[model samples]
Target: MTEDLTFNSKMAAVYEKNTRISIPTYNSLFAMIQSYYRVQLGEKAASLLLIGAGGGNELSAWGPSNPGWTFTGVDPSEEMLKIAKHKVVELGLESRVSLIQGTTDDLPKTHLKFDAASCILVLHFIDDVQEKLKLLGSIKDKLKSGAPFILVSAYGNHDESELQARLNVWKSFWIDAGRESSEVDEMVRSAITRLSLLPEKQIEELLAESGFMKITRFYSTGLFAGWICHTE
Candidate 1:
């Protein structure tokens, strides 16, 4: 299996524990985005594209109240897909959801179009800012005019000191577990690198360059939480 799959498999096994903290934060973020879209679009049901959907926790957050919406979730990890599929079946959301194993690059070929799309907490994991921009551009291509695109990523200059402090603790633990120094270094490098954490002005500039209009920061929390939306 690919290293990405290996890492995601390990993550899937432990993601529930991680979500104890992440879910609440992301849930609130998505909720605010949804409210904004509801008011702006005036639609109860939306066709949503979720890039790097992971275990489908975002769908669960939307809940049964918004039965009009349908989600097409895409991720690159088979292991993560397994977890998400299981949750979809268990929650009886199979009818409202479709899970695919791929990245944002594959969306256009999937022949799917969406009224709205979100890439939350997924951009930083991508190592290339240009590639991430290409993916966002592809989403814009698939959306109809006036459709909304929501993006959330770690914000640059928000509070790197805190993240760096946390990474130090994580690095020590990984080393104590007998991981090679090189492996630990790679982990630390990934954590500290902020591929999408450009300044707020820069983010808006990039969004405009990608053919999106009316870009705005919708929410933020420390350096970790950020939300921006634009229309096609």
Candidate 2:
């Protein structure tokens, strides 16, 4: 069986295009998020923090639309950041966008408090529940009080029937996107066993414990869920 794609240069080369095809409601989900940020923070001089800011897709979406919003995008993957940097340069957003090749904890300590933050399609990669909480906590620490946070992730407890059902649908989504049967099976297997996804309840608990409030989900596609929250 083929291994799951890692965030290396090879995957980074085709990441943008492949993700657009593989993930359901790919465009609209991010559109909603950017629109929400625009309406919610409108004209306010704010710095938006992006965790797992791979390829600067968020920057590309939000930068052109909201000129007042500056972005600090952090990701552990250097290859991914290289692609994102290129995008930033291409967009002529170098003046407004900052890319960091590290996790949130690696973000430089400063008096700068982010007014908004996002962690789209991330967090689920962490296998340990405590580590997930720590990641969220680290994000919370960087933001100002009452700042909005958008989090999107794939989730479902492995032991539950609901997770199994969602996994079936999720794999079908890939297959429908034109992936071969064997590839889909291997991808599905990796997602189920290799990825560390949590149940909704535990995720909520982790968010709450990490100082996020008003945790409400605004979108869901198969096993993936998008949440709008606040750091308070």
Report, for all candidates in order, the number of backbone clashes. 0, 0
- TM-score, prediction 1: 0.74
Q: Model 1, range 99-197, lDDT digits (tens) per residue?
A: 889986655575656888888777767667697678778778877778888887765643557656644555665566567879878854665553445
Backbone clashes in model 2, listed as residue pairs = none
* lDDT at 184, model 2: 84
Candidate of highest TM-score: 2
Please give the distance, in angstroms, between residue 82's alpha carbon in candidate 1 and its true position after superposition: 1.7
lDDT of each residue in 1-232, candidate 2, tens digit only? 1232333335555887777755768789989998888777877788999999977779888888788888999999887787787778768899998888889877888748999999988888887888999999999999988889998988887888988888788778778878887998887776557778887877888899999999998988887888899987
Which 10 successive residues of model 2 have the least lDDT summed?
1-10
Error of 2 at 158 (Å): 1.2
Lowest lDDT 10-mer window, candidate 1?
17-26
Each model's lDDT: 0.70, 0.83
